[model samples]
Target chain A: MADHLSEPFKKSAMTNEEIMKTQREMRIQFIAFAFMIALTFLAFIAVGAEVAPPGFVISFIIFLAFIQLFLQLYYFMHLKDKDHGWANTFMVSGLVLSIPTIVALILIIGVVKY
Target chain B: MSETVDVSRGLPAHPERATLEGKNKFVGFWVFLSGEVTMFATFFGTYLGLRNGTAGGPEAADLFHMPLVFIMTMILLTSSLTSVIAITAMKKNQFKKMKLWMWITFFLGVAFLGFEIYEFVEYVHYGLGFSTSAFASSFYSLVGLHGAHVVFGLGWVLLLLIRYNRAGITLTNAPKFYMFSLYWHFIDVVWVFIFTVVYLMGIGGG
Candidate 1:
């Protein structure tokens, strides 16, 4: 078993259906990539063109950032697939914790100055 | 365990997690990544809190060049895609294609790092030193942490490529490559927030 791990294989175990599924997955990934790029561009344009007030633009870009984040995490990272329940749990918890951390730091450090 | 993975049938569709060791690594890496999230959150919080504390030094609005940052964002984003492709190739047992895509990802990472270095140097010349102000210190630490990750990731993939130059699609290396892809994507995730919160907000007059 140990020796087999280091040796190379001549072919893949993927059946024809699995191969077709993988190809389909790749196409979906490409579409996700395109959406991410569009989101990025829109964020940049919003800031560049000054299409709205600074407050509105800031919120808009941050919203776009969140959308990009979901796309990357779900599609690119495969967090949307089955068998990712634990991965999803850990990541979502981390994200939940982050919000309070950021809010506290901004309110306490930036505003309160304690 | 022996019956579960029959090597004579060729590489598995999910080679990375076919073995118990590989499965453990997969889960462990995600745990570590969760910790990294909080770690980076602290830095992000610090930067946001102190961004307005320029203290007579160069501010974000003046120091950041939109075009340069936009280019860097594009480079990093594209590299993320390339690594995704590489991992997809890995799962498909296309060893040569996987290596090729990984190499492409490495070069793109190097290009992104180069721009980051150039951006930092330009900022220093513009008088935004590490100790120039609260903003400067926090900004450097946050962005610099991300840059260090890029450098580390580059070294990692390079070593993997060199060590496994001739080792075809083996179960042992599959998990390693897959984990690297995840790390690379996380870096891009961090950069997403960096650009939106730091660069965009900086130039947007917030």
Candidate 2:
């Protein structure tokens, strides 16, 4: 069929477009990588330098870690792209269910001996 | 190949999700990973709960080495980047580049396991053996399971390399490589939490 024959032609024709898209994606990936490294450095400095209050340092690094997790999941894992709705649903639900589980585990399983 | 069976000509843009088979594989792997997330969350919850139940043995502050942990974090984070590069190569259909990046990932994984083993040995030398306390048990369970995952991931990449060295970038092998990269990224994500909650907070005496 003509359609079938043209498929290969179309694929071949998209090389330039594909390369452009790849270049864009590669740029975003490099930016995310740099941000992750900077975040890691900040986390170490927050704890190692001992400049901030202990409570603030703990919360700050945890906050930075959450940002890193989001970048890893969305960018590195490609969860932010189209057609990943089910994957996103599953991950979000897992996080939702985990909150209660974690709360109960920490509170109910009280450190009686401590 | 026959026209009837080969619905798409050449490598599809998203070969890992281009066909019915590939879509099933892509979605199914995500479903499995969701469950895995819950499994690790349970381990993490257990660790947080029992972190202070040291049974009067060495606490986290007494055993953790921040500088060594920071180096390990860097190594693992770089390996994640390398695996991402491999995935990028796959997207571009650059088989040789993908293989090279995957090999780099494998070596980084091996290096991480080596450092982890050395870390465990150091902990034991410092008198924090397996049965020392509740904290010891949970820490090993959580972090040890992660190390086990890294070992499995390394073996997987090695197998993919061996089996597909001559096969090039076929549809059959693309999804396998894609999923392996996903798994490797998941390991790095978990380590991000470990260093944050375990090492940083521990050293901070929180």
C-alpha lDDT (0 to 100) for residue B77 of candidate 2:
92
Here, model 1's chain A TM-score works out at 0.95
Worst 10 residues of 2 chain A by lDDT: A5-14
* Model 1 agreement with the true structure over B120-189: per-residue lDDT tens digits: 9999999999999999999999999999999999999999999999998798999999999999999999
Model 1 DockQ class: medium
Provide DockQ values for all models, in the order shown. Answer: 0.76, 0.40
Per-candidate Cα lDDT values, in order, are 0.93, 0.83
List fnat per candidate, in order: 0.74, 0.42
